[model samples]
Target: MRWAPRGCGGTRPSPEHVKRNGWHDQNILVVSPDDQRLTWPERELVRQLGEKLYGTRNISEDRNG
Candidate 1:
């Protein structure tokens, strides 16, 4: 239940992201970013946040679960 903005690759970014990601994370419960089981919202938010943070829209749930 965390958000790292893709390339940021950190545990938890901000409290807001934590809250948002956490909400979705529970559904996904990714042991790592490489696991795949994220919800649609989780995936969308991650991708959006990733692009915002990394200046690229490459956030992928393909790796995260």
Candidate 2:
């Protein structure tokens, strides 16, 4: 399935935000069954949208990597 943001192309998730939050190279634990079902691109879109709307560190990253 192709996922696109309404009125425009979807945004891309940036590792920069994670790095800025000092979470780069850290393990992020995402616990969403539905989200997990999405393809890699879709998951990325979700992450990107979340970061864009809510700023960095919106999603928690697991530090045990």
Candidate 3:
């Protein structure tokens, strides 16, 4: 399951939903500026890391699988 840090202010998929889909990893994606108010360089780093781990697809794309 993917989750950004707190204060991101979005409706996250419920843990039960993720569990029903068999995704149990606590995969935290640093995709929000609210996470430490990341600087440009930090954001870039997070973006690269996220791409490496989760790929560049839209999150919805993964839902079908």
Candidate 4:
């Protein structure tokens, strides 16, 4: 699926608003039916977005290596 802003030619999901507030439920990456994994880069991206969405920011990183 493609996620581009209305007038941005359906580019990748890299909107300032999205980058700052993280991706919407529809945009969050899904690893499995029950597990969700966000990379370090993605984590930071979403953290900023969550802050804007909820007015506060809180993210718990689950490292598995």
**Model 1, span 1-65: residue lDDT tens:** 56656677846577656656866867532232232577766777776665666676454646456
Question: Is 1 or 4 the stronger prediction by lDDT?
Answer: 1
Badly placed stretches (over 4 Å) of model 2 are 1-34, 58-65
Local error of candidate 2 at residue 50 (angstroms): 0.2
Candidate 4 TM-score, true structure as reference = 0.30
Over the stretch 1-65, how does candidate 3's per-residue lDDT look in tens digits?
48767798677887657654553456533254225667888877877777787788465565546
TM-score of each: 0.33, 0.36, 0.36, 0.30
* lDDT of the candidates, in the order given: 0.58, 0.59, 0.63, 0.52
Model 3 steric clash total: 0
**Cα distance off (Å), candidate 2, residue 47:** 0.3
Q: Report the alpha-carbon TM-score of model 2 versus the true structure.
A: 0.36
- Give a tens-digit lDDT track for model 2, residues 1-65: 48766766766557656544554356654423235668988877777776776675623666465
In model 4, which regions exceed 4 Å deviation? 1-36, 58-65
Q: Which stretches of candidate 1 lie over 4 Å from their true place?
A: 1-35, 58-65
Candidate 4, residues 35-64, lDDT tens digits: the string is 246566666666666666666633356645
